[model samples]
Target: MSVQFVGLKEINGPLVVLDNVSNVGYEEMVELVLEDGSVRTGRVVLLEDKKAVIQVFEGTRGLSLTNTKTRMLGHPMEIPLSTEILGRILSGSGKPIDGLGEIFAERSADINGKPINPVSRTYPRNYIRTGISSIDALMTLIRGQKLPIFSGSGMNHNKLAVQIVRQAKVTKDGGQPSDEKFCVVFAAMGVKNDVADYFKSSFEESGVLKNVVMFLNLSNDPIIERILTPRCALTVAEYLAFEHDMHVLVILTDMTSYAEALREFSSSKGEIPGRKGYPGYLYSDLASIYERAGIINGHKGSVTQIPILTMPNDDITHPVPDLTGYITEGQIVLDRSLDLMGTYPPVSVLPSLSRLMKDGIGEGYTRADHSALANQLFASYAKVQDARSLASVIGEEELSPIDKNYLEFGTYFERFFINQSFEEERTIDQTLDLGWKLLALLPREELDRLDSKLLDEHYHPEDARMFRGA
Candidate 1:
């Protein structure tokens, strides 16, 4: 038998407090029948003996305390899933908004997913190529790895993200597409309408829309719905990867907005705030999302995550990003200074890292020379920074000849190496070859990071001279 409660105890901001409720569990779904007979959805956020507080997905505005009735659904919030989800657009709360009609779901799953057992997990080793040289060659993205991109407001992380979606592919040794079913699951929480349209058009233009499933929660939507956006997307992803045997890439954007919604809700609930006025469970909350990504033992499919969050004033230590750094495998940080200088992607090479890069590259994966080439690039770029700082003090005209060469190298590093046309997709081989071509510009003695054998085969001063002249 189902129980209904009338005359709610209280109506807080986006929350309704019901008294004398029995057999209610945390996160269980709720229904509100207003006096006007319109229905609204909610979930149990906090529960006490015979008293349950529900956070309404649609804000509570017209509900009269005396007339409204609340019903507790026996199950938690769930999303319907099927292969029919691809090429479809859904609301933040998992409703179809694309006018395509409801999905004929094969089954439904709890939005609050189960944590994967650590003992049954397999380490991520497969490399996913994004066709961006800066990422593919330097900060490699491994399948089943949780790598967050740290960006500041006004940076071009959106452009970079779109390019990544368009170019991401599963490849075996020598860059051939692996025989795996690949799909993308994208969730946007609290983003502007224009931003959401841009993503839709970009994916459609690239012809990858058929392989994508998008959940959009705009800034104008109710604050409470933002909380369910990512969880809903991940739930579908888990179904595709674990049940359907499809490799999935899940992208959650503007996580800062999500965190803000969490803070607002926590404050309303009278929960004590932790760092920066965020809930103390922020770390556990993030882990629940990030830990869902990985390769499960005996499963052919995997889930890789690229969560994009804008740091408040570029502060990496903000509670949102700070907590994320602790749970994720590594981070891809975007440089505001580089963006100011007209660099596309504007990736901060030194600060960005991929912890699983070592396991994914080299030998039969990308290339045997991938390890050495990456090391040499990092070393040389570090030198370029040093040389630039020195020149700033002594003036480029007064610098030694070796320092001047480094100044020129830095220009090429940014222009030809890091910067690429948004429409152009480069292969791993092409990126590595371009690295050698740039390295050849430097004198042989300066390339100390390269082994003697690599230098003998790849170093061609004559070719470098001709290319530089041309």
Candidate 2:
């Protein structure tokens, strides 16, 4: 038999307290029946002694303290899981909002998923190509890695995310494409209605909607739903990757919104605040989400995450990006300055890298020359910064010959290599070949990162002539 109680203790912003309740577990789902007999769903967020505080998913209004009835569902929140979830659009709480109706679940899973045992994790290897030159040639996203994109408000991270979804793919050794079943799980939290429409329309127009599962939580939705958006998305990803043997790429945009929702929830709970008024447990909470990404020991499918967060005022030290940098493999940073200069992706090379790139590229992977070429590009770009600094100090025409070459290389590298159009997708070979062409503008001695053999194979000083007049 189930236990039901009449609510009376207190009603506080999205929360309802039921005093003298027994045997209620935390995070257990609840049902609230109003005086009018309309039902609302909630979960137990707090428990002390015989008292349980339930957070209603729908806002708490129009409920009579005496007439409302509460019942515990005995389990944490779970979402339906099946292969059919693909090609579907869902609300933040995993409900179908596309008028497609309910999922015929093979099974359901807890949205707060079980952590993969560290000992059972397969070391991430190989790569998932984003088809953006700056990422593929430089940062190199390894399969099953949790790499983040650090951006700022009003930047084009949304457009970049759309482009990545359109072009990302897995490749075999030596840059051959893989035929493995691949799909994307995209979750957008606290986005405006138009922004939500933009994402849906973009994926549909690109003909990739059939391969994607989207969970959208608009800004007008309750904060509780915002908190559930990524969890539901990841739950679907885990189901696809571990159970169905699919390579699932999960892209979560504007994680800053999720963090802020947590803060708001914490404030409503009256918990002590930490840095910038965020809850102190913020790091662990973030880890719980980020750590969910990786490969299992025997599982052929993998889950790779590209979590995008906006740094407040472009401050990298903000708690959201600061903690994310610690948890993720590495980051792809977008630069406002580069954006202003007409760069489409605006990936700032110096601050962006994939920590797993070293193990994933070269030989059977991307290319044998990939590692050395990336190093030389980094070194040369560092020198470009120096040359620009000198030019700023003493004027451009008076700079040394080598410095002028660096200046020219910097301009072409930015214009041609980094500033690709949203519609352009480059192969790994094409990206590498472009890197070498830009490096050709520099003198031979400056190419210290590459050995003689690689330079002989890829270096063509004549390629520099194409940029001579420009």
- Stretches off by above 4 angstroms in model 1 are none
> What would the per-residue lDDT of candidate 2 be over residues 1-470, giving only the tens digit for each residue?
68899865899999889999898888899999998889999999999998888899998989778889998888899999989899999999999998989999999999999999999999999999999999998899998999999999999999999999999999998988899999999999999999999999999999999999999999999999988888899999999999989999999988999999999999999999999999999999999999999999888999999999999999999999999999999999999999988898999999999999999999999999999999999999999999999999999999999999999999999999999999999999999998998988998899999999999999999988877766
For candidate 1, what is the lDDT?
0.91
| Among all candidates shown, the one with the greatest lDDT | 2
How far residue 232's Cα lies from its native spot in candidate 1, in Å, is 0.8
TM-score of candidate 2 relative to the true fold = 0.99
Question: How much is 79 displaced in model 1, in angstroms?
Answer: 0.4
Listed in order, each prediction's TM-score against the native is: 0.98, 0.99
Error of 1 at 56 (Å): 0.6
lDDT by residue for model 1 (1-470), tens = 77888878899999989988888999999999999899999999998888899998888899888999888789999999999999999999999999999999999999988989999999998799999999999999999999999999989988998898898999887666788899999999998999999999999998999999999999999988898999999999999999999999999998899999999999999999999999999999888888889999999889999999999999998999999999998899999988999988799999889999999998788988888999998988899999999989988999889888888888888888888889889999899989998888789999988889998988877656644675
TM-score of 1: 0.98
How far is each candidate from the true structure, as Cα RMSD in Å? 1.1, 0.8
**On a 0 to 100 scale, what is the lDDT of residue 274 in model 1?**
93
Report lDDT (Cα) of residue 451, candidate 2: 96
